[model samples]
Target chain A: MSANEEAARHREVRNAWALSAPALILLLVAAIGPLFIMLVYSFLTPGQYGNVEWKFSWDAWIGTLYSRDIFDGTLKLADAHLTIFWRSVKLSLLTTIITFIVGFPTAWFIATRSPRSRALWLFLITIPFWTNLLIRTFAINEIIRNEGLINSVLMWMGVIDQPINMIYTDTAVFVGMTYVYLPLMVLPLFASIDRFDMRLLEAGYDLYASRWQVLRRVIVPIVRPGIVAGSILVFIPALGAYVTPRILGGGKNMMIGNFIELQFGQGRNWPLGAALSVLLLIVVTIALMFYVRASTKGTNNG
Target chain B: MTTDVAVEARNAVKAFGQGETAVRALDDVSIQIRKAEFFTLLGPSGCGKTTLLRLIAGFETPTSGQILLDGKDITNDPPNKRPVNTVFQSYALFPHLSVAQNIAFGLEMLGRPRAEITKTVERMLALVKLEAMAGRKTSQLSGGQQQRVALARALAPQPKVLLLDEPLSALDYKLRKEMQLELKRLQTETGITFIFVTHDQEEALTMSDRIAVMSAGHIQQIGGPREIYTRPVNRFVADFIGETNFLSGEAGEGRVTLASGDVVQVEGAEGRKGKVTVVIRPEQVRLAEAGAAETIPATVESLVYFGTDTHCHLRLKDGTEMVARLQSPASGEAGLQQGQSVGLRFAPGAARVLED
Candidate 1:
């Protein structure tokens, strides 16, 4: 702590802040600004023609899980919206679990390859994203449709009498979502597993542990941070996913994002849509907080 | 001829890659590890000693030849199927498991009863003197503590053979010295065949029952510490194990002739009549005052002082360079200054004349 060194450290801190201030200001304007506007709009009333009336009201908050019954001047729980929300939550959880089950080994394969082949495997994992995700979602049709590649091949081989109805089903939606978001799960897992010290696995083997025990007791526990990170990456995006469900789900099994879109589009209720958006954000934030707490607890115990 | 050999490698060969880029990591190596012996494979880096150790541990299969454990062929056995364990150089304890859990891992893998596992883990914790730290995370341990954990975890399973890969190399000098004795004590008590690998000559000398000296993926010699140091079969083993002064000369029956036409009498010349190199350790070349009988004439160059001794560097009449360690400052000719004439004496059978 010489005086000159202290002055230099202060200068470094000042320079760092100076370099970072522009990005901070940009985030405040672009990201936080919209959220603030949305929050205020959720408290405002909607005018006759889908415009914000700019007056304060709690009616929009009340309308999030309720719809007005014009005959009785009373509120009733919006069963359709609740069902959509619940379905979105369930599908998101399922997607996270499936992605993890598949991603863990995929990440391990990438992480354990020779340095020359590791880059190639990672590149192959991300190849699905070469085309736009929307196009890839549509490509599923060529495989799952009645006259698509799968049905044609199956009938030509005489394995099936008719094409199975896969489109607009929950299975199709899950398949589409899993394929689209798999890289999201794998990248974080790879980052963590790659940094793991492989000697621990060797030690496990030397101690007479089977390959399964090594993975269960050694590899999985060490890479838990990656699992948590990958789960978060898949779960949050899958919860708000509207594109895959709209196209693959045939608008039949609507996610929360589709519900929100309906509120702003055909439903023409701007205030209710804003309020629903706020509710989704609140739910995601609470879930994230719970995850963060649990992960911290895990680290503390470890 | 009939000692109970625990581990044996017969003409093992290991090669990596193919075509023009191929490399032989182990070249036609064979060894016998006796039961309950502290055997060390000593060599410099890239000398294939560690590879040989891994082969015995069942981590690597030989490209050719057979490995036997207690007279049973185990070359085809996977690592987990073999009754051998290793204390890795990195001491790869699971970062998530506590010290006791790490020691208990092998027993659990064997499907041992719960009471037996607990008792064995408690004994291991006591053996490593880590009982007070049983619940502590391995990540929280010091290097020495973690090393003990690795040793305890490997030894807990009571394997027939234990492999240690440069286990003490990562510790500080004081800790290494202490653990060397500790390891030897543990081996004596357990009566397990210990195969230790290291490049340090002193470590091999201090700890091993016998040392296998290797260089460039080839074994040069295998013998007890005294035998290996006193009678190295080749130049590589002589140069690697300790400091030596080489004299180029021609060997006759009990005599040798220097390049400068000076004749020196020596025993064990192998009765040959070609060029040879006589290797002598520094301490074995005794330095005395000039005009001593049966001593070679030499001029003192410098007396380099070590704490307990002085190395008297000198040149003989035939211009052969030599160094002799004097154990006492008051020893003969030790007080001689630079350029003083002194007579150098070789102890009986101290100098070994090797065929070049």
Candidate 2:
């Protein structure tokens, strides 16, 4: 509008940028820089030994979906690659759903405790986090293994002649992932449910809604942001999870993370590894975008 | 159990926490709300007015009593099973729903036909005069509009009775007055037995057809607005309903002898003796020149100038303090001075005697 006001506004913008410059520079160097390097390598040629070459090629990107035969040089669909991708997506979705089923009631319980004991309940929820993730995964392995506690107790009771072969399978991975990612779901759900107005329950009941209807129609809709947050928190990490699948799946079953790691280590294809890593990042980004959309829509309607 | 009685609470006692720490919130209270009447539970906070209302709504079960709806026992029925709804103190409209959806919620829960629900929601929106805000979220509304949506939502189900739990307390003064009239009109138009709960005496006096004055978990009195204001049965009801002067004296033959050797006529002291309390409303006391006939001599203590009336604070010879509301002249003050001698006269049949 005026020259003085314009100058002052310009100074404010400059000051804001100056204040944020450090964080912006750190993000670029620490986070986006490696991702940019991976993107560039995905477009380049793969070397004989385990790195990218200067020469450019689309072999790595093409190899992601279609594998070229070594002798015939004929292209065909990469069934193994497709299977790993499908398993990754499926297991991650199941993990999200299972964690939600177990976590919603847990969060509700913790949120409904009296003020003095609510803190204790929340502390108990986070007790598993005190230990390392790998250690916890191993602890789970100890229980469901062939000679683990469950099998030993059942065998001692003479109910089964043989121990169940639960280890080294998809079920093992699912159990381990659900165990590991459950707190992720519960914490956000707790945060939302704790802020929920208990009086709305009375209002819902007064409105002729059954208890089931109240939960589905009132409580779930109000706490939906927590559901979305918890789902994202579990789903994105579960999609690209490496440690649990590696330990629990026992090398026979592999997810996208192990497959990507195999390309760089044993397969010696750095470009393909980079391409797969970038693809996983894209999937996580899309999930986060949906989260943003859903959360914003929730607030707008709420 | 009469057909005219829409809801009845028979000797209801509600206690919170047990084993010696128990506090009786409603101590063996009984009340009958007639059909299509605007009955109010009025008292200060912790007087168990809300507890009584909750008992009727089936939110809180009585410890050892029965609640009835049209002569049917509903004591053990849950809130949802009862054909009643509540407009909460906070106007607890669902935040995620539009105004129209909030109104349609009860009908949908009751499994009404889709067309009927649509029609009822439309009519409710018009009843509260929020037709344009049907699509707006409850959070997007102002306090008064949210209040209307709460009303519409509760009324949409067409319950036999509507329980309002201090619903107007959240509104501002101007809006509270507007909604008071709006609530009265809604009750009249719907012809639903409205059980309203409030602490504000003025609100209860203005809106309710019958007021139940409560104190310390007991129903002190229940009567029409005029009856409760003019003919309170006890000191608590008289002091609680409005501003009043309480004078302790000996009563006999329709006359009271004050402690300071003055005599005054009280209407209800006939054939009574010994100690009693005289209840006289401020507006019923008229100030006149000193030493007038059939008057009590008093000294002016202070004068508060209200826009419509001037409150004259006075002290009697027996050290009893009293207030008289004098109408201010249109163009001037009431012309009363502090510390001046005056005579106080009670209007004919204005004073009632209560047991001390």
Candidate 3:
């Protein structure tokens, strides 16, 4: 090739690399580097001098597998971590299911409205998300506590003999988490439902399909993508949450977030803490993979 | 009760809003669609054509009317309980279902056995010539394919009457022409009463056995295509169906005299003598030599050359403008030029006298 042709090709390659360098480096630092650090820490052991050592060994993994007495006696191996993990999973699952049950009807109502009314409803849904997450959790706490609004109202109505034990329980955690993530579940589903064409429902009715049949066969399938997207939004955050559960669970009935906190805080066993973090990441990763596959199949078939 | 009328709307009065702002969409409109015939409601936009279609489909209830299908009064019935199906303009196919499942949806709603639903869906897919795409997603299909899938889905239920609301306007020009013939063929093969609503005059004229031309919540005329085109009942019908040269004149004893000093003989001229519009089709006007008996001297104003015929815009000395169609092959008018003088004539019954 001529010198000019060679120089043009080199310029094209240089420009392409230049344009992609920022994004590539950001990905490496924000995502890839932390994951590499976590993987290394997972294989490391606590040093004799009260710090993590760089020497690689499978001792942490083996200890987790075989040290039944120390791990189980302390209730962190199978019972404690497993219970916390399952609790987190259940809480997230319930949040997702409840959000869908509520969000679908809410989105349908909003979608059928006039443009001005729909805009107003959208503004209302977003107003709660504007405040800080801790503030919202605390607000929930104040409302359900001993001297809170429900107790005050019950006492005034003379229904209860004394203030009910309302705060610091699993129910409290569920309420706070659901409140925080309800909008997250609603917005995406609303987007999908809002774009739904009403003519299809009309067509369904004309074809002798009952209202229930139309909802089952047409509406649900068409809005599944939005449902999947919203479910993921609610499920992932509820799974890894520390603030809402910490405030609402009141430290006694702790979830995985508190377990992770105690291990790294007062417990001071960084290797076990790293292992638990790694386990949480693995669970989330598997779930995200399944979600991606299901969403892809839905779009492909549709 | 034993009559064979597939669908009938009796004095249907559908109004929107209330008080002064109310629009009577269908004002005492009545129509009977015979069994297994292709009936078309042809009108311009905002003429209540779609409203009428919705009323018959049971999507909307009329203010005061009785809708009967198969001799059963279905005036207050919901759409799901009616023995009718509609193909929407947008098709509205279930985006998440395959073509086979989309076609089988109604049968599934009816609680048909899975095997029966499958067999019927497959047959419908073949009928619409979309069996190969039965497994494909609706988005993967073309516009015409979606239209056929919609047709198959609606037809699989075998309703008493089928409604189509401008189903072909979404297609391209060539595909729409092809689908028009396919739709007619489907109607013949299935023997289903089709009530189609469209604003396209050509589509209505070509496909419908009988057409109701509606305007402003009123049906201007209802007849066969030829009769509606030739014998329009009023000036609105005449002007809406096709182009007509409206020569305002005074009617007298068996003759009408134009303001431009031209006179023409017409039938039924003695009944109304004040004023009338002489409706003449472009092709009916004959170009002849300057000395014919009924000929009037005219000057060619403009010449438009169509592929098959040439349209000559003429202006008489009395300031009446008229158009005549001449068969010309060449690009330039053969032996005709703007500003040239000629004589225009027509047969005795060429023009239809109409009330404005």
Top candidate when judged by DockQ against the true structure = 2
Clashing pairs in 1: none
Query: Per-residue CA lDDT of candidate 3, range B202-233, in tens?
Result: 89889988899999998889998988887888
In candidate 2, stretches whose alpha carbon ends up further than 4 angstroms from where it belongs are A1-4, A287-302, B1-3
lDDT of each: 0.88, 0.92, 0.85
Work out the TM-score per prediction.
Answer: 0.89, 0.96, 0.92
TM-score of 1: 0.89
Candidate number with the higher lDDT (2 or 3): 2
The digit string of per-residue lDDT tens for model 1 on B219-251 reads: 899999999999999999999998898888998
lDDT of 2 at A120: 94
What tier of docking accuracy does candidate 3 attain? medium
RMSD of each: 3.4, 2.1, 3.2
Q: Tens digit of lDDT per residue, candidate 3, span A232-261?
A: 999998898899889988987677777777
Better of 1 and 3 by TM-score: 3
> What i-RMS does every model get?
2.4, 2.3, 2.3
**Across residues B197-255, which tens digit of lDDT does each residue of candidate 2 receive?**
99999999999999999999999999999999999999999999999999999987678
What is the CA-based DockQ of model 3? 0.60
- Candidate 1 residue spans exceeding 4 A from truth: A1-20, A40-46, A52-79, A124-131, A139-164, A295-302, B1-3, B19-22, B270-273, B328-333
Model 3 chain A: ten consecutive residues of lowest lDDT: A59-68
